[model samples]
Target: MAVQSPSLDDPRVLVDTPAAIVDAIPPYAPRSEREAEFYALGDGQMLLNIGPHHPATHGVLRIVLKIEGERIVDLDPVLGYLHRGVEKLAENADYHHSIAYTDPLEYVSSLFNELAPVMAFERLLDLRVPRRAEYLRVLSCELLRVSSHILFMGFMALDMGGLTPILYSFIERDEMVDMLAALTGQRMLFNYMRIGGVNGDLNHEFLSRLGDWMSRAGRQAEAISTLLNENEIFVKRTRGLGAISRGQALNLGLTGPNLRACGVPFDVRRAHPYSVYPELDFDVVTADEGDTYARYLVRVEEIKQSIRIIDQVLHEMPDGPVMARIPRRITPPPGRAWAAIESPRGQYGCYAMSDGTDQPYRFRIHDPSFVNLQALVPILPGCLIADTMAVNASLDPIMGGVDK
Candidate 1:
């Protein structure tokens, strides 16, 4: 038996297909300099500006990518769009006045931002934070960590085109924020942590609400896991993508879950033991595979650990003054001190130098998002152009922190 093929000369098929029209068209000279420049791209690679506005960027993050077709040749992450000159602003303000300015650094996990400066100021002035205050600090910090990671996981999934996870994650996040608001006045940027301790003690309503949220946390966590963790599309998109070795992660100054994802057991709370972290018993979560999926898993595991820490803090909470006894005006002698905390993003630290006056001589912050963001420079090369968003999401550099 023989099979007859359709002929290219068939007018009906030719008109229906693109080939006949393309062949019929005649080539013309470049009409202007713009047309000539556009045609010149045929012989060379192209540079694309993804955004200072695209949705996947998380903030006002612009990534300039040089590519050869679908393969990325180079990527440059542009920052400073959200910069408020926080360090400079803090230097001009009084030691106590500067605490509020730190809130926007990592806006999602604002408690950690507040914690760094408060700890630094406490160390600089040799102020003693009460045991009850320390427990409150740990509880607030851990709750913020859990809340930040939940949003991070949701955004990571959202970048990969999953919407349900963000919706479900927000449900949990609002509950946590609501409880935090009952303690402090604000929900997101709760400038809760003060120099000696927290602004106020956790109220009964906040405690009762926290207990309710903790009880059902596992179910909500499982909902997100079911949506993404083992899904074929999520796995295929992330499993082996943007892998970094342990040494490279260390060399790049990666920290938090991004660093832990590379199998490094370095956590500021565990290693340096700040506040009540030394008293708390919780395992530092790490993943051997340093890929996007591994980063996701590390955050999820850390959320569980944070919940465990919160439970312990609640159970063993001591009764004492939430705020330490201190002078009305804080005028520390000339001294410099640095303090760090394990934020959801990484090692968030603040350095303060007192000049014998009320204001700090110099105030600086070490934002983990800024350090973790550099990981993308090494990880992005050779990845497909589409994978750029996935890699950025895994790095999770909040521009508020990065550009502060």
Candidate 2:
């Protein structure tokens, strides 16, 4: 039997040739000239682009990173992929109609986004909301917060290599969103909050389910905490990873769980009271460690706080009109008004300027995802490539809110 030598023309033989392989590959080029500045492929550093469409980014967020081995030496977040010109659209829409446009600013917690614009309109028009309306608003917003946080916890754990928590979180979140849908008619994007007040009142069925959810929320939280809180891998991955000090967090304009995790008791609900938050009894959940683990704990504890607030609202809810006595067409006096609240992510604020017209002269949003996302540039450096997902998950930025 003759043993034939491997042919040089063979695809396998060609791939094995070092010179042929090098010749086959082309030199890398920057996507744009502006992007050229991000390249620092000198010595041991190499340029890495994470995604405009990465699952770990949580949305359509792209991050350019310079890595030395597995450690990120520098990073720049590329934003605006999901921008929809929400502010410009709100400007042209009627004050009453503008509530609909604000819903997508923070797509996950649409109630909070809607709340900002409606609250601004109420202030802009100097409209007095009924006490019952205030109570209902608190109830709806807290429900939305819990729902958002539940899903956020799931995603965070999932990013950190735990799959069970995401499912457990969705279990709670689905029920919460179902209750919200019953009250608001929509699940994810709720345009339920009107200019003066909410579109409709919560019915007995919604309230009953809410009571049941409130009862089981503690047990569910405990179960989740038990599953992930002490897991050695989770603890090692998140503990002391991407730690942000109190000053750094505040300086970066971090809020909500991210800020609280840094030991700053700067809840917009407590520090800057809005709606019926002043009347509600709840403690600001905080932690000394501002790492990924601390952020997780802060959010879980916050779920309990939100439940407590909803309980208070239920007990003290007044019997009055759900909608304020405002005309069909809302035209605020020619002036500017700003309203902000503790959104699930952080401070979700809206600024509206009227020029004595039905449409707003100017409209702007101060989204927490946008602001808290800034903290990433600072926290990302010195963190390992594997830890990037964990750190970004801790921030929990939604591109809808970040880019809006």
Candidate 3:
């Protein structure tokens, strides 16, 4: 025979239940601290840990979400899993030698990373790059942007459960990588830019092959756009999901496509013209809807614009020295300067402090992805679990850029 435990409200029963009986009963603990706090604060919430290894977390990003049923009460992003003290490392490396380090900071757009540091060094040294070199840098950077976006398009499709686009996009990406390798002798980490100018020049045959490849790539991009852009499912999934208002985006310091998607035509290439961008004729694409779909559209349009820029650069490319006249052992007078470039992801800036030595006294990188990740906390709430991955993939925050 067993005795039933008295209810707590029943004052007649002193001992509510035996220890064994209590142990046998299910524990009455709150599901989570958030749930307990929700009840305490009268907010009625629970906590959910999204991912540190999720495919859509954009590489090791973890989010702590306080949810009231399906609605989010609060969002906390956990980062630092990929931090490698790159800024600290830059301080110790020579200004010219530091180009190798910046390449991996944003591995997806390594060329632009190299450009920022080299451009800053050029500015610090007051070096004038030849017209041909400037044109080459523009051509390479624009093509690199398209290549980076190609990877994004592929991976974003993969995240959305479509594998065919990945293979198709990679076909173009492989060609671009091959071209980059032909020029710089390395595929991904080109280390192509130096303090004063580029490491090499575009030969006649290489340019001709690139011209043919560009025509093919343009056709491929159109096919991709047709396949994904008009699909009803892709549109439905992306439209109005993770929408960020212009006010919210501006307040968060969002730039590049993220900001442009909010209908602000603020592109560093256009607004703050660097390299040969001022001479190039291209439209700054913007969309009224600041959602995942809008970001997708912006990147798609950007690839077309990059193609146009590359074509123009190729046609107008002149013959001259690729490297500016600078001492082999670069050691600028003690000074500090900032240089920003339109990277594939956004406006990437490099702030360097030189101590009149071969190495820098301090080196800091203003990675656009780090600031863009801040927008996640605000937009992530009120989105479904599946949409979380879509939103993250759409933002395209590179973890190496974020963590560094």
Candidate 4:
């Protein structure tokens, strides 16, 4: 019997070949460049461009992958497609005016982005926010975190093949957004925090309503947890998927729930203690599995913890001015400083370089989504393609945050 070898020119072979095989073919390129530079050194392997729009790419992300069978040999993540030149725009805007731009940078968690820039500006000007203002900021930030996490939980469940939970999650989120909208006048992109304090005080009626909403939200969260937590399908889909160990997560700069899922008790609220966090009592949630399930569990527990923090801030909130006594045209001395807050996703920081002007000389944002995306390369190789969406959703990255 004669064995037929596969021929590259055979149309049948090309047509019948699997996508993995088709992806192995190298694209034609210029030969003027160094071979070692143009092509990876050593044995030739087919390179495939996964996407700038692939659902699993997270958002507007392009990944160059060298794969052999189901195993990813090498991976390169390409970003910047969503970049809107926010940092550059901030340089041109005056100190107070820049808050508008930061609000859109992390669209999902705009409140935190606003907080980062305004808080940095406040620090630069040595502005003192009133105790009431501090508590308000804490309350709102925690609420924003809870709102963001609820969205994540819903979307993640959707990616995991459960759709009902997302609707339930969004029902809770809509209520929270309505509550925030009542206070800030904007649902998602709220430029509510100013250099010295919040935009306005929470009226007594608003507080009374918020307290009632909080009670209802707490009960809703508990109900949702009971429905999803014990569901066999959810457990099977999430459990033991996309595992990341503590040391690896630390090296990759993973923060927030992604870091906490690895059993590392390093929350900015607890570790650094900013805002009114020092006075508020709340537990830092952690999980040992460092897997998708662990990440989900960490966030679920975090929502509960945020409730505890908000309750304390509301109960003990003091009465005073919300803004500082800084001059109308504020300017700080030439200096640089870093300020980080416990955003819904993780540690969101702003590194501001001022040149003794109202406008910042240079502003750099250390967004957690961008940092957390790094962990994908190490973890993607061993998992199946279906699990790609699972892992990406587990990371819960917002492209605006990553690109900005």
RMSD of each predicted structure: 10.6, 5.9, 7.5, 6.2
**Regarding lDDT, does 2 or 4 come out ahead?**
2
Model 4: per-residue Cα lDDT over 1-404, one tens digit each: 88989888888876797775555334466354443342462365556666787654557887766666665665666689999988999999898888898988878788899888887887787767888888889988888888888878787878777778778888888888788888888888889998888898887656766878876766666766786788898888779988999999999999999999998999998899878888878899999999998898888898889888888887898888887777778788888878999898899999898999889999888899999988888887766656767888889988888998
How displaced is residue 82 in candidate 2, in Å? 0.6
C-alpha lDDT score of every prediction, in listed order: 0.87, 0.85, 0.83, 0.82
lDDT of 3 by residue, 102-186 (tens): 8888988788998888888887788888888898889888888898888888788888888788887888888888888888889
Model 2 per-residue lDDT at 102: 78
Model 2 Cα lDDT, one tens digit per residue, 330-378 = 7778998999898999888889898998999999899999888888888
- TM-score (all chains, Cα) for each model: 0.89, 0.90, 0.88, 0.87
Better of 2 and 3 by lDDT: 2
Q: Count the backbone clashes (under 3 Å) in each candidate.
A: 0, 0, 0, 0
User: Total clashes, candidate 4?
Assistant: 0
List the candidate numbers ranked by lDDT, top first.
1, 2, 3, 4
Task: Report the number of the highest-lDDT candidate.
Answer: 1
Clashing pairs in 1: none
- Candidate 4 wrongly placed segments (more than 4 Å): 1-51, 54-58
lDDT of 1 by residue, 1-404 (tens): 77987887888876676652343222577677744543343445766777889999989998777678898877667688998998889888888789899897788989989989999999988999998999988988888888888888899989989888999889888998899999988998899898888888978999899878877866677789888888999999999999999999999999999999999999998888878778889999999999999999999898889889999998999999999888879999999999998989999988989889999999999999999988888898899998999989988889899999
Q: What TM-score quantifies how close candidate 1 is to the native fold?
A: 0.89
Off by over 4 Å in 1: 1-43
